[model samples]
Target: MITHTTQSVSKANIFLTCTDEKYYRDELIVEKNTVIRMISGEMKIILPDITYVIGAGDTIFFPRNDLAKVWKTGKDGRPYKSVAIYLTPEAMQQYAIKHHIKPIHPSPRTGIKCMAAHPLLDSLFNSLVPYFNLKNELPESLAEAKVDEAISILKLIDQEVFNTISNVEEPGKINLAEFMEKNFMFNMPMDKFGYLTGRSLTTFKRDFKKAFYTSPQKWLTQKRLALAHYQITEKKRRPVDVYLEVGFENLSHFSYAFKKQYGYAPSSI
Candidate 1:
């Protein structure tokens, strides 16, 4: 799994990605922005309630400050490829001024949404392919211009998408139970989940018990163990690989938990 931010090279938020396979990895997106172009391989982004399979040539626009769990896998051992351009506050402010687009507080209708393929978008992303191999970071001016070009395409792609990218994204105030069901695979601390769901930590735990009739930690253990067992036996994934993917911190603890749940060691299966 690659954990890199284009923030290192340019504050413009142009990041390059190359991956062979990624586990169920947790990530905190710094900006609620648009223009995720998948160039090659396969990518899956698991939001709290929705999931998307982003194959090569697919583009997705995500909400700002999204806490996501993702799975990225390659085709035939090749690296998965993509670019993410986040809408920096400065950029959004500038766009609103130049386009005479008002700052509207309209909330996005979906968790993470895909934009239909546009030839303009296709060409724009294609132009970025060579940057991945640059020995040094892209020049600051060039990176910002590329990001500008991407946003220009959004205005003509779809209105819904345009609004989603243009507006400042607020956290969704959603059903607690529904949120947990979709996000349980993430191995983050409880507070992170609570914050993402727009709840105080104490309120989150209380609501969690009311919905699950069980403690969050216990539920997470059982859920992860069950999935680990399924992967080990049915999918034939190695124990080493399954442990972290399902949220366990390490092998020894995962082994202990799996045995307690299934009455057998993971390797025994």
Candidate 2:
């Protein structure tokens, strides 16, 4: 589902897409720093400076001024499906000032990329992604509240990523570890991931294990099944509905994955 809303004063647009499917290769012209969150599935972001193949748990912050190409790659070297949130800078700045935090500025380094797998940040991203997608007019107080939460998460990420940059080396070309954590919803296609990175599939898998301490496929499946569990328990809806809602195309596949992850049938829940 894609949702769109605009702020009257700033005329900033917020676009939201929540899907259990893959997206096609495309580019967005955003006038502000756009936060892309992977609610489910995998996404391959091809930026001018770097290409990021992010899984469910991962996110990429594309500053407003940059132009980038994005592709949705699926498992089996195919384009994986994904959902995303897009926000304009003016709206984001308003959210920031209301929360008493400085808005994100262009990094001193051109094309600087920051990646982290903080749980709070993930939650805040998840919450706001939908909020901005749904509302027409945001009251000043509500906007401030959302801004505060977002800022808190951003500050934590800043401290964790920037303060410790020296200790981590170049932080790796791709934040595979963080991607896996944030995108625990499906298995990433090693071949596709490699293709994006200009690496052989074999080499990509090897490097992914070395960097993330896990195989890409295994990590992705675990995340997807876990997300399925969460959605089932939290939604209070029918089991079959949850299945399709979370991106599984068929009941058999969904049931198999659910039992594999939780050792129970969907009906058990």
Candidate 3:
């Protein structure tokens, strides 16, 4: 089993995440625009259309309201370590107003944004490493200052990323079928799916029925199970490996549902 740990600097949105195991994998529903600096080891981000790998000394950005599968791995006997700073809407708005910043042009990219090496980025993240050893929590004001400094450095180094982070547009109504088809494997609540696809709960269910000809719950389960079945049988993956990756919360439930759907347990495959 993987031993995962995270340390934070008080009320600041910054985080230091580590894992002792050789590899750790999980899913994320990013709630805020986030920048991560890889300190050691490597991280691979799997998106719907692409995958991004970040190594030590690499800086990458994840936009808000995106679903991704992240795989982290240790290297050369060292644990995986990274510093992640979430860019809050309030902070972005405040910085924009204070700096007289406006969106230059909308970015068409949906995948991870990678930036070239810069001294300011390196200096900021290096200074944060020692805070992990502190006994007392850092003050909120100091933490916010660090975040603000990062925002300023970003504006100077990468304007495209600066614009992407500064803009906080709500998701507009998009094609429900195309969206759901790509994102059905993520384990989110019905309402959250609705919100991300720009619909209310009532509208989500109604539109889901029209698009899938079935209830949301039923369609999601069937699709997840079908994908799991393919992975287990065709790809020769184990039941344990396939269950969580397919959105089932537990092994027993996944086994029960797999048996019900195919008239046999997943392990039998």
Candidate 4:
């Protein structure tokens, strides 16, 4: 088994983790200097139209608030090792101002891109591993410099790409239909869904009804239950595994909902 570990480079507000696992993640605003350098293993992201598979040494820059349906897996020794720099919206704004850089804002909105092939990325991560291993607290100024250096390398490869992504935007900036479609599996509250899609509670509900022709709650439940039914009947998955996979918090609730939706127990499927 891979021993899952997370190390925070405090000065930079960056967190590093290496894991051998799988999960369903909610739609999130990328709130950090979001860089994932895949050191080993393989991962896949299922978006609306495409499935992107990333292997070792590939670097992808995920702009803030870009919803991702991420799935990761790794084997015994070669676990999924990744380096991430967390950046708040404030940090990016400040960095841009201090460096005298003007970031272009896309009119409709910008999507995430694969900023691959930064030559210094691997060495840069290697240098930071010692800091993570040591667990030492460092000055915030020094951490700021590290982030600058990261940007410098990224800038060298593609300054346009760097400037575009490094520029942060408000949460809930994504389209409601697209965001919900990409992230319907994770079972979060309706209010959270509203906030993520960048709408007031009333507006979220009103918009959701307009788009789906049903209440958010009813539509979400229908989506989850449909997925569960497909998993059980087509994939030969067990009720025990299918419950959490389809976003039910507990088995009993899942069973109740499953029966209510399908008129039969999940196991009987």
lDDT of 2 at 213: 82
TM-score of each: 0.73, 0.42, 0.87, 0.77
Tens digits of per-residue lDDT for model 4, 119-187:
597777676656666556756787777776777676777666566556566564458887787778766
What is candidate 1's CA lDDT for residue 37? 84
Q: For residue 192, what is the lDDT in candidate 2?
A: 47
Q: Give the per-residue lDDT of model 3 (tens digit) for 1-269.
A: 55656433433688888777766777898889888999888888877667788899999988888898888888777778888888988898888788887755556644568879999999999988888787778778788888999999988998777777877788789899999999888888999999999999999999999999999999999999999999888999999987877788889999999999999988887
**Per-residue lDDT of candidate 2, residues 1-269 (tens digit):** 23232122221233444332333444533234444566555666654335577776676666433445555544544333333333433444555566575534333432425466778766766665545444466465665565445545555666532222112111224555654454333223456456444467787788788986887766666666766777678865667655543435578987888787788987788
Q: What is the lDDT of residue 170 in candidate 3?
A: 80
Full-model lDDT for every candidate: 0.74, 0.52, 0.85, 0.69
Candidate 3's displacement at residue 180, Å, is 0.7
Residue-wise C-alpha lDDT for candidate 1, range 1-269, written one tens digit per residue? 45432122233477667655443244544345656888777877765557778888889877665656667777655567777887666787777787787786776444477778889988887787777668787788887788777777877777776676666655656698877776677778787778778788898898889989999999988888877888899999999877876778789999998988888899887
Model 3: lDDT equals 0.85
Q: Which ranges in model 2 have alpha carbons more than 4 Å from their true place? A: 1-14, 19-23, 73-114, 126-144, 159-269
Candidate 3: stretches off by over 4 Å: 2-11, 21-25, 103-109
| Model 3, TM vs. native | 0.87
RMSD of each: 4.4, 14.8, 2.5, 3.7
Q: Identify the candidate with maximal TM-score.
A: 3
